[model samples]
Target: MSFETIRQVKKFTMTSDERLFALINATRYILDKKIDGSFVECGVWKGGSMMSVAYTLVERQVTKRQLYLFDTFDGMSEPTDKDYDIFGSLAKKLLQKNKKQEKSSIWCYSPLEEVQQNLSQTKYPTENIIYVQGKVEETIPETLPNKIALLRLDTDWYESTKHELVHLFPKLVQGGVLIIDDYGHWQGCRKAVDEYFEQNNISILLNRIDYTGRIGIKV
Candidate 1:
């Protein structure tokens, strides 16, 4: 797909173009490798990243697999002390803005309906799309797919990121793709991933995509 076309998808996402491109390629990679399972994204704010996956499936004329999107759809949840660095400052700012605005002014306040509308506009098969609206800590296990071909995590907090990995990573088929959107940018996210890997004895080398993004295949 042309960069211009990807830019259109980027409008619905907070991801950089480079990260978006990596997502597209990962979508295609799973398909090309004939990996069996669904595409899952945790922390789908506006649904742009998943939309890119949907677009890639359509562009490839393959639409059999399900697309699962999980989110709170009301901006970010509160970050704990474990979540520090840029993410911590940004969260504090958003909280202050919320108090001043007094109108739930949290970052990534995308409603489920709005996200549905955006994905529906892409001509991707609506039946193939699944939206789980709630905290990952609450909704993941019950709603997660049995097998995941591609797993993308962008929650940017320690607890949520850890929750996602604990529940979802096991379901990822051996050779499945895992993309972390905030590994280099958020201390909490990086800590969660590193801790998960350490606890699980996972030694996969995460390939860098720009400064914040990292991708690795499960062996």
Candidate 2:
């Protein structure tokens, strides 16, 4: 895969949704420059977006760039009432649904195996893609290598978002793109980013990619 091929994939996957296009373009831009370091997604559900990044990298013939995908493969962890407030009613609905499901039913949460299988179906070489399975706190340290050129955070909760920022942000290469998939869509996520940046005494350079999303490049 070369830069041209990556451009083709972006063109094919283009959507009216500006956030989606920003994601594709971000991945393409990173690969086209042959950026140093690896690519990582702190919260990959079903590997949809990360797969986009991987496919683009492969298409661009990017070598020596590892793609690390991190996830619990299970649903969100337990949340307190305060956390629940940030998540809104969806959390309650999800909890209710979980209680109603049969223990033996396959209607459970996504597993790491399923995500890996999906990636394999892409026919991209397995050599460059690495799967890190576990909770964000436990998995992020292990997933992040020495340097990261592109870091995508899609964990849609307060705890997970904060954990990733604290543990993973320092590893990001200067000028690296940090894409937050749940930024403005979820209140808890928005609060997490705000609090994290505040505590660090650093201000995030937010670029509203769409009504529900934002991305920032590390200075």
Candidate 3:
């Protein structure tokens, strides 16, 4: 996308929350440090934040890094206890029954096609952004190519967060930024981060952005 296009998008676009904008600026600053790696977001919902990052990169004329987006294109996978305990036993039982009734009950969520269509309307070049579609567990292992400079994890489920942390954390660069979107909002996500960091013997300094989000910069 060109500078003019970026300005236009910024003009009519719905601005992100203050904390989100701060996080984006932090990401851009980290990317500006001449890091020898790429950018990636594990769970992109409607491509808003990721698109904003892409546009910022374009506006700054930063062309060396690739922006990779990984998502199921579907909302989320089946709720696992590691993430959905508060939903109550009845809700769990209902979900179980639904699962028994339908083999792909979770597939009812939005697909990647809609997200792609929305991106098509933007000036972000398709060449710079790579969309990897599939459940994180099934797609991440095969999709992540090299060390990442920026790793954003927005998966709300405990299993999903844990899976990504295990499979994708090692790929993050030394100075990479790891942004967890659901860190403070969802109990399951917080659990996953806490457990994973403990198990791996790695201490991350989490900088809480807001009530719903927290970020950790890998050093």
Best by TM-score: 1
Q: How well does model 1 score by local distance difference test?
A: 0.86
Candidate 2 C-alpha error for residue 155, in Å:
1.2
Residues 1-219 of candidate 1: C-alpha lDDT, one tens digit per residue: 747558778678778888999888888889889999999999887788988888888889998889999998877878877776554564555455564323224457788898999999778888989999888898979997889999999988999999999999999999899999999888889999999999999888899998999999999
lDDT of 2 by residue, 136-214 (tens): 8777666568988888887767888888989888888877888887676666777888998998998669898875578
Write down the RMSD of all candidates, one decimal each.
Answer: 2.4, 4.8, 5.4
Instruction: Pick out the ten consecutive residues of candidate 3 with the lowest summed lDDT.
Output: 99-108
TM-scores of all candidate predictions against the true structure: 0.93, 0.81, 0.80
Full-model lDDT for every candidate: 0.86, 0.69, 0.69
Q: Name the candidate that leads on lDDT.
A: 1
TM-score of 2: 0.81
Of 2 and 3, the candidate ranking higher by TM-score = 2
Query: Would you list the rank order by TM-score, best first?
Result: 1, 2, 3
lDDT of 3 by residue, 61-178 (tens): 6755677878877555666665543433422444555533232443234467766766666566778678999889888788775878777887677888899999888988887888
Colliding residue pairs in candidate 3: none
Task: Tell how far residue 90 is off in model 2, in angstroms.
Answer: 6.0
Q: Evaluate residue 199 in candidate 1 and report its C-alpha lDDT on the 0 to 100 scale.
A: 98
Report how far off residue 87 is in candidate 2 (Å). 8.9
